[model samples]
Target: MASILMLTAATRRERNDATSFVFDAINACGGWIEDVHMYSNKMTTVRLALPGTAIEDLIGSLIDGGIAVDPPEAPASSDDRERRVTLQLTFLHDEPDLMRDIPAIPG
Candidate 1:
């Protein structure tokens, strides 16, 4: 059975680069991307379908590549059926100065 894998990642790299990096990792681990959504230049979410057996390898690859991946939750049931796995990756970056150009308020 094919399991659904949902991944959310935040990257500081350019959009194309971040996407490509994820694509490469998934392909290398014998998974295919079903869909991908780019929320912003720094955030991307991907849905993948692959054999349940390959899930560990895919997650390991992402972590080995310097992505901080959260562990997937165990399936609710013991039945051998398709399940949904969710993993989240967060990349830390310095917060931008929102008021850099704003003039100081009068005291």
Candidate 2:
């Protein structure tokens, strides 16, 4: 299977459960959380490595859970089905330059 990449938009810079909510959504979408990176706790992008799960479902759950976001951008095709893929749950608020800490998926 081809790995997927996504970017979710956040509404604010601060919130108590914003991070937790995202995690919960991921779990509900069949993603097993091996590790989590909280970039800013309540402000910044979160990179995830969800395997065998559809990101579209995760986005829907996040929005229904009160975290509205834009559709995930174009995904790069890959043959590395077993590679650990990363997903970016970013709190960009539309600022493109805010993308900085997204971990590179090594080739």
Candidate 3:
């Protein structure tokens, strides 16, 4: 089974570390990124889809690269059937824990 870890960079600010926006390295690590703009915030959203059930190495890599994570966004309706295991996330960017946990329910 494949699992996705998504990290949202809250603002336009960036860091000067080894993990500082290296697109090639991220792609090499089996990750893809989408840039989002919300009002004044230019967020860099990264999605890492890991192969198989093992997620430790990927999580470790994200942590090493200064990327923070949150629990998988919850599904709407009681019938949604995705099993999610939450990794310990770094709260550096401060997740919008209240609103973000709930995935949008399509009408």
User: Estimated TM-score per prediction?
Assistant: 0.62, 0.55, 0.34
- Please name the candidate that would achieve the greatest lDDT relative to the true structure: 1
For residues 15-82, could you state the per-residue lDDT of candidate 1 as single tens digits? 46556777898778666777665543445667765556666777677767667665554533343344
Ranking by lDDT: 1, 2, 3
State each model's CA lDDT, in order: 0.58, 0.56, 0.37
Q: Looking at candidate 1, what is the lDDT of residue 57?
A: 72
- Candidate 2 achieves a global lDDT of 0.56
What are the C-alpha RMSDs, in order, of all predicted structures?
A: 8.0, 9.3, 11.9
* Clash pairs for candidate 2: none
Q: Report how far residue 67 has shifted in candidate 3, in Å.
A: 2.7
Which pairs, if any, clash in model 1? none
